[model samples]
Target chain A: MELLKQSIRQRGIALSEQVLKVDAFLNHQIDPLLMQAIGREFAARFREDGITKIVTIEASGIAPAVMTGLELGVPVIFARKHQSLTLTDNLLVASVYSFTKQVESTIAISTTHLSAHDRVLIIDDFLANGKAAKGLISIIQQAGASIAGLGIVIEKSFQQGRAELEEMGFRIESLARVISLKDGQITFLD
Target chain B: MELLKQSIRQRGIALSEQVLKVDAFLNHQIDPLLMQAIGREFAARFREDGITKIVTIEASGIAPAVMTGLELGVPVIFARKHQSLTLTDNLLVASVYSFTKQVESTIAISTTHLSAHDRVLIIDDFLANGKAAKGLISIIQQAGASIAGLGIVIEKSFQQGRAELEEMGFRIESLARVISLKDGQITFLD
Candidate 1:
């Protein structure tokens, strides 16, 4: 967690005091070493949660979910943003509102991947409005799967996301939680 | 390679005459143990490439790139689709035509991460027509970076992908070179 916070402090750029551009190591590009360490951190925290699968969205969330899946020795199932012709099956689908893209996009996972017997750990790169996490939870709910916990890499604590998940009584753990971003400075939560 | 072939033989599903879906372990749903094996396999194949980086497109490709990067002890930088507001200065942008979706999408990468100093090894989940690979190569080209080689999990040998890449003189190594999928029978080429 310290390593991730340091990495964010070092390379992450604050855009307009609201968004942090961590494209250098977290979003666009990735530091595998750091990701592995973050995965280990999540593994240590959630190893006893009976997590059978690690779930995440497409594009940005795949890296963190894969790394965490590697640490926990579980399978990683990612929801697809773009429905391709190859994906033809009964799927658990949900619509997510992205704060960044500012659009409501549908994400879905195969019903065969999730079941009532599975304990899913939802992981992602960022959580701002908690829309993506909510969508993932909806899909898991549709499959009748239990959520072991929520694991996030970087969270904006000042946003309404954490409160929303906590209100739902979900155990959400983030490696780096930005309490506030003021004047290009990042503050961490306790 | 033998292990990969064995896994493919065991778990891979034949959708149609020409479509073989390894989504259970390769893309949609990832098996961590198998991914570890895949990581090692890629490391073995690209051992002589002296790869400084592992690069790939988002979504399905992120896992393999992460695994390969972890195996190689290098960083992985995944190219993102669509225009991101966070990415103010992206250097390399390439258009990739997806045959399955019949849409040409532009994938872009930041110039700061890739440079002439980095030798990138491109990794992907599938290579059908090599359009994605070519797009990735275009990004690398824009940054003036050297492409060490390409490592793909699966390649359709009957398709023109390999030929296109070979015509461009890009050294491509596919773990499973699928020759044909006739009547749900998957065949591999040497």
Candidate 2:
């Protein structure tokens, strides 16, 4: 977490009071070493939870989810943002509003990938309004799978995402929690 | 490669004469152990190439590219499929026609991530018509970076993807090459 926090402090750019761009290391352009460390940290945090799989959304979440899946010795299933020709009709779908893209997109998972037998740990790059996490939870519930927990790389605590997820009885663990982004300065919740 | 071939034989589904689905282990629901082997295989193939970075497209390609980056001890940068708020004006963009999605999406890389001094190794999940690879190549060229090579997990040799990339003077290493997918059976070039 120290490494991640330091990396954020060094490389993260505050685009505005509400936006932090970490495309330098986390999402768009990734430092694989940092990504691997992040994965190991997640595994250490949730190692005893009996997690059977790692679930994530498309694009940004795949890297951390894949790395965490490798560390946890589990399979990873990422919900696709759109339907592809190869995907089957048996699916669990949820609509998520993206604050970044400013659009509502449907995320879906194949019913074949998840079931009552799966205990899933949902992972993602960032949690702001928690809409994506809620959508992932919906798809996981539709599969009749139990939630192991939610692991986030970064959490915008200034927003109500953590509180909302916590109120829903979901166990949330974020590596870096940003308390506020006031006047282009990021405050971390120690 | 034998392990990959066996996985394809056991889990891969031939939906038609042209489509082979390995979603059970490769893309949708990913097996982390097999995925690690894939990364190691790619690393081995391109180990001598002095790869400074691993380049890939968004969504599906991130996992393998991340793993390869970890193995190669390099950074991994995935091109964004859409313009987001966090992205800057400095970018190298290319339009790719997706055979699966039946759409043309522009993939862009931040110019900050690539430069003329870097050697890029492009990684992807599947190679069919090679449109994605060509798009990536265009982005790399735009960055003025030297290409180390292209590593593909599966190549549908029945398609003209390989021939086209090879004609363009790009070195391609595919873990498994399918000679044909005829009568709902897959034939490997090996």
Candidate 3:
């Protein structure tokens, strides 16, 4: 976690008071060493939750989920996002609103990948407004799977994401939580 | 490679004669153990290429790139794809035509992540017409970086992808090469 925080400080850029661009090391381009460490941290936090699978959304979330699945020795399933919501009998689907892109996309997973007998851990790169996490949770529930826990890499604590998940009675763990980005400075939640 | 071939034989689904879906273990629902094995196999094959970074496009490419980066002790940078092309001074961008989706998406990477000093090895899940690989190659050339090589999990030999890359004079290593998908049966090239 310390390594991640340090990497964020050194390489991450705060474009505005609210937008932090970690595209240098976190999302767009990734540091695999830091990612592996982040995965280990998540595994240590949620290893006892009986996680049979690690679930995440496509694109940004796949890297960390792959590493975590490797560390936890579980399979990783990523829900694919589509432009429009498509209902299918063989898939579990959910809609997510992207505040950045200002568009709503539907994400779905195959029913065969998740089941009532499995325990699932949801992981992602960023959690702002908690929309993506909520969508993933819905797909997991649709599969009749048990929620092990939610793991996040960088969280915008200033946003209501954490509060929303906590209000829903879900355990959330994040490697780096940004409390504020006031005056283009990142303040971590101690 | 044998393990991968066996997985394809057992879990891969042939939807029609043109599409083979390995979502059960490759793209959508990923087997972490198999991914790690894939990374190791890629690392072993390209170990002497002096690969400074592992590069790929977003979504499906991130998993294998992550594993390969971990195995090679390098960083992985995935080019983010956007619906409409965004041309920026700070980014190296290229347009990739997806034959499956019948859409052209623009992929870009930050110029800071890639440079003339870097030797980048491109990795991906599937190689069909090689449009994605060519796009990544364009980005890398734009960054003034050298191509280490290209590593693919599965290559559709029936398509013109390999020919395209070969025409461009790039070395490509595919773990499993499918000669044909005739009659819902996958025929691998020896």
Candidate 4:
């Protein structure tokens, strides 16, 4: 978490009051070593939760989720943003609105991947509006799988994502919690 | 490589003569241990190529690329299929045509991540027509970066992808090469 926060402070760019760009190491470009550390941290936090699988959305979430899956010794299933031709049937689908992109896209996972007997851990790169995290939770619920917890790499604590998930009784663990990105300054939650 | 081949034999599904779905372990649902082994293999293959960075397309490719990047102790960058609000200027873009999806989409990478002095190794989940690989190659070229080689997790040898890249004089290493997927039988090149 210290390494991640340090990376954010050093390499993260505050584009505006509400936007922080970490393309250098977290989003567009990735630091594998940091991702591995993140994985270890998440695994350590939720190791005793009886997690059978790790779930995340496609694109940015895949790296952290895959690393965590490795550390947890579990398989990772990424919900697809773009529906593939082969993955049409038996899907656990949810519509997620991205506040950054300002568009609503459907995220789906094959029902064959998740089962009622499994305990799932949800992971992602950023949590702002809680829309994506909520969508993953919806899919997990649809499969009748139990929720292990939510693991986030970077959380915009100024936003309503964390409060909303916590209100829903989901245990959330974020490695880097950004309290504010105001006036071109990045502040952590400490 | 034998482990990968064995996985394909056991879990891979031949939907048609042209489409082989390994979603059980490669695309939709991922096996992390297998991915770690894949990373070690890719790193071992390209360890001496002087790889300064690992480049891959988003989603599925991120897992393997991140693993390989971890092994090589280098940073990994994934091209974005969907444009982000913050990633608007100073971009290296290429249009990729997905044969399976029958659609063409633009993939872009920020100029800040790639540079002329860097030696990049391209990693992807699958190589069929090689359009995605070619697009990454174009972006790397635009950045004035020299390519070390191409590392693919699975390659359809019967398709024109491998031949096309080889004709273009790019070094390619595929862990699992499928020579045929005819009559529901999965045959390897070996």
- In terms of lDDT, the poorest run of 10 residues in model 1 chain B is B82-91
A best-first ranking of the candidates according to their TM-score comes to 4, 2, 1, 3
Off by over 4 Å in 4: none
RMSD in angstroms between candidate 2 and the native structure over all alpha carbons: 0.9
Better of 3 and 4 by lDDT: 4
Q: In angstroms, give how far residue A55 of model 3 lies from its true place.
A: 0.9
Model 4 TM-score is 0.99
TM-score of chain B of 1: 0.93
Steric clash pairs (candidate 3): none
True contacts kept of each: 0.80, 0.90, 0.68, 0.81
lDDT of 3 at B102: 64
Task: Give the TM-scores of the predictions, in the order they appear.
Answer: 0.97, 0.99, 0.95, 0.99
Please, what are the lDDT tens digits per residue for candidate 4 over residues A18-47? Answer: 888999998899999999999999999999
Highest DockQ: give the candidate number: 2
Residue range A1-190, candidate 3, lDDT tens digits: 8999999899777766667788767677778878889889999999888899999998788888888998999999989885311113288889999776667888898897899999999999899899999999999998899998899999999999999999999999999999888887988998
Off by over 4 Å in 2: none
Q: Can you list the residue pairs that collide in candidate 2?
A: none
Summed over model 2, clashes come to: 0
Q: Ten consecutive residues with minimal summed lDDT in candidate 4 chain B?
A: B80-89
How well is each residue in B96-131 modelled by candidate 1, as lDDT tens digits? 998766799988888888898999999998898788
Docking class of 2: high
lDDT of 1 by residue, A1-190 (tens): 8899999989998886778899888888888788888888989999989899999888888777878898899999989888776677798899987777767789989898899999999999998889999999999999999998899999999899989999998999998899888998888896
